[model samples]
Target: MTTSLTIAQAAEATGLSVHTLRYYERIGLLDPVERRDNRHRRYTQEDLNWIDFLKKLKATGLPVRAMLHYAELRREGNTLESVIERKAMLQAHTLCVQHTLAELQENLAVLQRKLVLYDELEQAARAAGARAPRNSAPTPPTPERMAP
Candidate 1:
C-alpha cells in the first residue's frame, strides 16, 4: 500500500504553507482532499505530484481563476478538446512571457552600456582633478540595437 501523507506532511513535501494548502482547498484550485475517519486529511502520492504541478503552474503566472478552470477541466478527466485548449493557452502565455523577458533583457543591456560609459567618463574626470562638464553628451544606444 502507498503511504498516505497528512496535511502537515503534504505541506512540508510541497513547500507550501499549511494555510496556503487550506486556502487552495477552500478555492476550487484543489479537489476535495480525502480524509480519515477522524477527519484528518490524507494525501496520496498523486496528490503530492498534483500539488507540485500546481506550484509550477502558479509560478508560470497563471491567474488563480484561470488555474482553477484548468484544474476543473483536469478533474473532469482527459478530454481532447480540453487538452488542446489548455496547451494553446499555456503556449500563448509562454510566448508572451518570453517576448517580455527579451525586451527587458535588451533594456538592461542598454542601461548597462550607458552605466559603463558614465563610469569611464567619471574616472577620466577624476584623474584630471575636475568634474565632468555637462555639455555635448555621448550618443545613446537605440532600443533596436540592444540585442545582446
Candidate 2:
C-alpha cells in the first residue's frame, strides 16, 4: 500500500503553509490532489516529491510564471518534444542562476576587501594611540580606490 498524508501533514512535511499548498493547487502548479471519501485531500509520496522540486526551483529564484510554465509543460506527459522543451527551459534557467551567482560573488569580494581595510585602519589607530570616533565610522574606500 502507498503511504499517503492528509493536507496538514503534507504542509508540515514540506514546510509550506496549508494555504500555500491550496494556492499551488488552485494555480495549476499542482495537479488537483487526490481526495478522501470525506473530501479531504490526500497527498501521495509523488505529490510530496513534486512539491520538494518546486521548492528547489523557488529557492533558485525561478519566477512564479516560469515555474508555472514548467508545470504546464510537465503535465503534457513525457513525449520526446516535451522532454526537449523542458531541457531547454532548465538550461536557460541554469544560465540565469549562474549569472546571479557570479554577481553575488563579486559583491561578496568587495565586502571582504572592505573588512580588511577596516581592520588595517583600526590597527593603525591603535598603534598611534588614537581613539576612533564614538559615533562615526570612517568612510570606506571607493571601489576605484580599493585594491583589485
Candidate 3:
C-alpha cells in the first residue's frame, strides 16, 4: 500500500479542498506536512486520520484557538496525561452541546404553542370579518406575553 499521498491526493481522499488543507496547516490545526524531494507536500495516512478528527471538531463548533491548543497537546506527547487532557476538552464541549440542545428543545415547544394560538386567532379573525373594528390591536406575544 502506498503510505504517502501528495497534497492533491490527500485532498481528494479526505474531501477537503487543497486550500482548506493549507489553511489548516497554517492555522495550527494540522501539523506541518512533509515535503517530497521535489519540495511538494506529502501526507501519510496518519495525517489523513488526524484531519478527519479536525473536521469533526470544526463541525462541532470547537473554536479555532481551543482546537489549536488541542493540537499542541498532541504534538507535545501522546502519554496518558495527554489522553486525559483531550478527554477533558471533549467532555466540556459535550456538556455545552447538551445545554444548547436543551435550550433548543424548550424554544421549539414555545414556537409550537405560538403556532397553535396563531391558528386559533386566524380562525376567530375570519369569523369576525375584516371590517370588525377592535378596541385595540392584540398585544405582541413575547415569551413573557405567552403567560397564562
Candidate with top TM-score is: 2
Clashes of each: 0, 0, 0
**Better candidate by TM-score, 2 or 3:** 2
The lDDT for every candidate, in the order shown, is 0.86, 0.95, 0.90
Reference-based lDDT, residue 124, model 3? 91
Question: What C-alpha lDDT does candidate 1 achieve relative to the native structure?
Answer: 0.86
Candidate 1 steric clashes = 0
Best candidate, lDDT-wise?
2
Model 3 Cα lDDT, one tens digit per residue, 1-148: 6689989999999999999999999998889999978999999989999999988888778898999999999997889999899989999998988888899999999989999998899889888885436676767779787788
TM-score for each candidate, following the candidate numbering: 0.75, 0.87, 0.69
Tens digits of per-residue lDDT for model 2, 60-103: 99999999999999999998988999999999989999999999
CA shift at 57, candidate 2, in angstroms?
1.0
TM-score of 2: 0.87
Off by over 4 Å in 1: 130-148
